[model samples]
Target: MSASVRAVIFDVGETLLDDSTFWGSWADWLGVPRHTLAVLVGVVTTQGRDNAEALRLIKPGFDLVAERAARERAGHGESITDADLYPDARPTLGALRDAGFWVGIAGNQTERAGLLLRALELPVDAIATSDEWNVAKPDSRFFERLCTWSGHRADQIVYVGDHRDNDIIAAHSAGLHTAHIRRGPWGYQNADDPKLRATATWRINELTELPALLISSDTG
Candidate 1:
């Protein structure tokens, strides 16, 4: 809303969707105790290590594909649905679009994310994923592709996310304004990181703050 920001692209997980329940269910489906999974996630996240690496360390032979298939066979491995969206998500997105801003969802996700979001009927103009783009966040190529998809310059876009490294620092490095939302595991874990907090253009408590922040930016 700086007159230069024409689009606002959001990270899917933790940004628009509350993934704690999804991951809890997945842990149950994987036959691992929820507390155990939580401990592993916390340890790795606190150490600033990749979650995938933590999975490998814990399970030793973890196969995501097979685990997913097993869950589907158990009849609960379907993609996330509307219920996974945060309470503020739909209203915030709708309000943004109604205000004439281009809204998009772009983040690390499977190719099916687009299909799932569309099924849920979110008011987004574009949706892209790491699987679809063959690139992921913190990677310059991913930001480049996102810029192209938004049809806006890097500075004309504001990337909102919860992850300090993957969202705030990465997007800022790519020349996009960044909004760090304080929710989700990564958000809480990285909350004390001075560098990460310093890079964010704005720090928000929830999605509901976005509309007013943009509006104020425009008027100010």
Candidate 2:
């Protein structure tokens, strides 16, 4: 890790979790084809809209909280499990800690999602969610809370995530270094945007690349 960058914080959804099952389950609940929902997600997100708008487009005034309760009642509650983690998540996180870097997970997730992450017992030092803080990404307050929670200055943290707006641009605006990982839908779509790409301190395809990148960054 770079001496100047003392901590590495991550965004939860595409940064660590695959999130395919989350959306797939929602598609099943809505009785729509998975591909249909996937396509709509891409469309909405590409247009600078929230991914949840896809669900709203399918069903007007879709209340996520209400639907979540309905799913739980039907024994189909949303979940996050080991299977949702990308193969590189564990190894990379463990490596960062082993190398003596403070690590944390903070993102626009429900409080339930934060609890689920803690249940997994990853090697991170902290785990937080939007609901837990009463704030979400693209909102500067979210990153402000993250900086405080991590006990690191804005420049001392490298915020890694998949989304351009929420992860790269927002983190940068908050004065933290940003890593835009190229994976999930948002990852691939924004990867090609030169302006967005330039905003990131680093671009990587896998979490496994971070340690080496950060280590070598100081020398470069």
Candidate 3:
């Protein structure tokens, strides 16, 4: 698998940064109650896979997250910017680039993820925003677009992200290898499910672990 891979893609939000404190603060400032907020966390961390149908059960929280995003923007006059990525992420990306992996973003996200990437100040192949695609991960077209843009076959690339269903599922459907970043509540929500793990060709925590994970199947 390592020999075949030429590139790697990443999901930006919770997979990369500790976004809970920021999002939680936003929720409280926007007046969402704690219980409703917990359900909203479920929808977002799980990524509203059921979406409109999930709305039937979580309508209030869904609307609440949306409303909070709106309120935070109004109250602060802008969304979050320059979020701190976990430690060693910058060096890890540099190492992957050094190893000739065409690194990039492959999942859905917020405006802040861009700023985080910019802060890294390294060259990556591209950042495919699922927000722009208007279709999040687990959708084949999203992965297809990534493969097309990177000019590689599905098997030639790897999709790394936080969500089991969206990023890994979409990458698998596209025939790419998957790297599941098992961290925080996000990974916890889906880790116990075997079907989710099946999509990930690799699973990891620290970004610094990625280069070796991508390049060294020789580990014994």
Candidate 4:
């Protein structure tokens, strides 16, 4: 990693949020019991596509249900204030920002997800959304936009995300330092994930583990 790493651009969905809880919140606000509501996401996400693919296919339905759920619970989108934040996300993000890093989100998400970030009160230097770009992760367009917006060169920014294909491979192709947030079943099971098997890079179990990687990335 370059010592010139002045900015850290992050992926949203699984990186900053569990995404499942967001789905669960939808069902809960709809008056479904929390446990039963889990099925709501299960039903939609179980179609065999990974979260990335499922997102593109199910986003419209996800948004419709989310609006319905929020309206049922609190009468408007403002009710997202009560949604769950992924465990440790607030702390990790806040810590990075506090550590003199330029913190921002370079993610593929529906417009509604931006609303969710505001509800959570997360601070970011910049936010890029796929709805606006029409290009999703694993495509370098998202990263390219981020560099243009942040005015940071690719070599000076680190992109952290979950999917091997979307996060690691794509960013690597763009010449940014890529880090994989190893959370999902697909990543762990797919040892041959393009990210893990890609040229030497750092992988971590969680966001808070980043500083060590920054220091040790070139130890070899």
Question: What would the per-residue lDDT of candidate 3 be over residues 32-132, giving only the tens digit for each residue?
Answer: 66556556667755664543333335344457447546765677422334355666555766788889888876566545445545555655767656666
| Deviating ranges (above 4 Å) for candidate 2 | none
- Model 3: lowest-lDDT 10 consecutive positions: 51-60
Write one digit per residue (lDDT tens) for candidate 4, span 1-220.
3367767888877777666666555555555666564443344344535443433343445465456555656754423342355576777777777776787886777666666665566866777678767777777777788788788898878888776667777888888887777675434544355536673266777788876566444522
Candidate 4: segments with Cα more than 4 A from true spot: 25-83, 191-195, 215-220
Model 2 Cα lDDT, one tens digit per residue, 1-220: 6868889999999889998999999999999999999999999988988889999999999999999989989999879999999999999999999988999999998888998999999999999999999999899999999889999999999999999989999999999999999999899988979878779999999999999888768721
* Top TM-score prediction, candidate number: 2
How close is each model in CA RMSD to the real structure?
2.0, 1.4, 4.2, 4.7
lDDT of 1 by residue, 100-124 (tens): 8999998998776767877887898
lDDT of model number 3? 0.67
Better of 1 and 4 by lDDT: 1
Task: Give residue 27's error in model 3 in angstroms.
Answer: 0.9
If ranked by lDDT, best first, what sequence of candidates would result?
2, 1, 3, 4
lDDT (Cα, 0-100) at 60 in candidate 4: 44
* TM-score, every prediction: 0.92, 0.96, 0.77, 0.72
Please report the TM-score between candidate 2 and the true structure. 0.96
Backbone clashes under 3 angstroms, per model:
0, 0, 0, 0
**Candidate 4 deviates by what RMSD?**
4.7
